[model samples]
Target: MTPNAIAEHFDTTRQAVSKHLRILTECELVTQKQQGREIYYQLEIDKMKEIDKWLEQFRKIWETRFNQLDNLLATIKNKKNE
Candidate 1:
């Protein structure tokens, strides 16, 4: 999407959107192609998928810890009632 379009969707200024796109381009998460007077941006989906998979590992650990905390709290509540 053009920076103008992105800014409209994000409710931000086009200059702000362009700045973010520039950072993404530098990080290699987005690629920019020039066609005549237009600059088009494309996301690197494979990079996104890799990041998602990496974060999922931590998500699983957090889920397990939260489940254990819930169990512990329930046990304490039951003991207080006994």
Candidate 2:
């Protein structure tokens, strides 16, 4: 999406959105193409997939913790009812 479109979804100014997009571009997480007067940005999907793969271990850990928390809450609720 163009910076304008991205800015509309954010509460900040268009310039702020552009600034972040610039950083993302610098990080090689996104790529931009110029068409006519507008520049459109797209995610570097391969980079994102690499990031997701790296984060998968942490995601599993968090999911396990959340499930344990849910089980504890359920036990508390059962104790309260009894």
TM-score of every candidate relative to the true structure? 0.74, 0.80
Residue ranges of candidate 2 with Cα displaced over 4 Å: 35-37
Report the C-alpha lDDT of model 1 over 1-82, residue by residue, as the tens digit: 7777678898788899999999999988899988888888999999889889989999999999999999999999999999
lDDT of 2 by residue, 1-82 (tens): 9999999998999999999999999989999999999999999999999999999999999999999999999999999999
- As a whole number from 0 to 100, the lDDT of residue 18 in candidate 2 is 96
Q: What is the overall TM-score of model 1 with all chains considered together?
A: 0.74
Those runs of model 1 whose alpha carbons end farther than 4 Å from true positions after fitting are: 68-82
Clashes of 1: 0
> All models: lDDT?
0.91, 0.97
